[model samples]
Target: MHAEPACETSLSTPPSARWPVVPLQPAVREAAPRQPATRCSTCSLRAVCMPADLTSTELQQLDTVVLTTRNVHRGETLFRAHDAFQSLYAVRTGSFKTVVMHRDGREQVTGFQIPGEPLGLDGVCSGTHSCDAIALEDSTVCIMPFGQLETFCRESRRMQRHLYQLMSGEIVRESSLVMLLGTMTAEQRLAAFLLDLAARFQARGYSGAQFNLKMSREEIGCFLGMKLETVSRMFSRFQREGLVEPNGKQIRIVDLEGLARV
Candidate 1:
């Protein structure tokens, strides 16, 4: 047979030598949402919530202990009655209302909390929460683990004294509420409430003369121990008397002294 026409067989060429190898890039991934870390050293409410005299070292320690923060949506309960207490929460934003439910299903509003206030003190005594702490608006809180806080308190005499002061303040608040309910008239009670709010807001560097009311009239009545109708009437009367200007939830204290006199 005539020499098989020299067939060029390229099968002997290695595949790797024939083609350029390209490295594959890692598959792209979507980033997850980030959780905000608590930084007490730079917090605006540090002056209000934390002690003024804390050294930089103490503040850094606080930041480590208050590493976690929680968001509580409007009308959601932060802690229900009888829940095991592990942390004390400091209000970082918005407000809360503490409520207690009776066997008959009646809800009693105990107190309202604004920014820079502390919660879960009641749990300290019994190791469980005594009432439901519901958010009045979308809110955030710095969670201080109680065990860590206790250890810190033991180390820092200033922090320990501050904790004792906070407890004493709670007792005073309860006593004041009892006095308001027992001795004051409805109008006086309302006046005292407004003035108290003014002072608190003022302390927080807000406009004390005018502010929005987060609590509803019905909730206000529940707290003030008055009927809803009575609370509405009182608000109307205050408006007519030019003591306060109430346009829905917005309140402008037209005559601070006059309201105080009531």
Candidate 2:
């Protein structure tokens, strides 16, 4: 699920002031030429992506339909707000965050994406994207053209069902995030956030109790609706209380139940 700000809010600014800053890096290099779709069936994320319910012959057909693979550098914008929606992307590596730039010029983080996650669903409703998808680190993605997907779904009952599931999950995730922002205390929110990340990692067959925090502390605070200092203080408190062992970006859950109690 992605977390969006309650409103046009910035941790450091007056309510009316806009958040200032953008990735200052130069444009990313162009992506490599398109590769064969055979890569899709063999992708580790096959279960989470296109090949989930496809037979060998179906997978072969899929290879012809996936548009291309793309490489994105850290700080690069994959697609900007209002960009025409053409495809949905599955993260093949690294991570990304979707952001919505406010009319006042502030930016609100909408969601963080990891491997196996599909992005660009927001465009389904409006035809144009509602936010910018930016890479949090060097990443690669498999592009599935939405038009092709729709046609395929019409022909494959399993694929159609899976597409419905993805859409339904996205809606549920957004609702839960809204609740998290409205009713939870800061500590409770942070605790739940960590638990959710752990659960997601475990689902992907990674260690659930320990992992690296790919996003920066400030970014975490921004997403959590807290100041950077507040995020730091909470992490320190968690460590002192023996709930977690955080060393820089590395975090190990020492007491998962204790954290849940927070």
Give the per-residue lDDT of model 2 (tens digit) for 100-147: 776676667768898889998987986777678999999888888999
lDDT of each: 0.80, 0.78
Tens digits of per-residue lDDT, candidate 1, 144-239, equal 889999999998887898899889999998778767766777788889999999999999999999998999988887787777877888899999
Each prediction's RMSD to truth: 26.2, 5.6
Estimated TM-score per prediction? 0.86, 0.86
Model 2 scores worst on lDDT over the 10 consecutive residues at: 20-29
lDDT, residue 102, candidate 2: 69
Error of 1 at 145 (Å): 0.5
Query: What's model 2's overall lDDT?
Result: 0.78
Give the lowest summed-lDDT range of ten residues in model 1: 1-10
Model 2: residue 60 alpha-carbon error in angstroms: 1.9
Off by over 4 Å in 2: 1-38
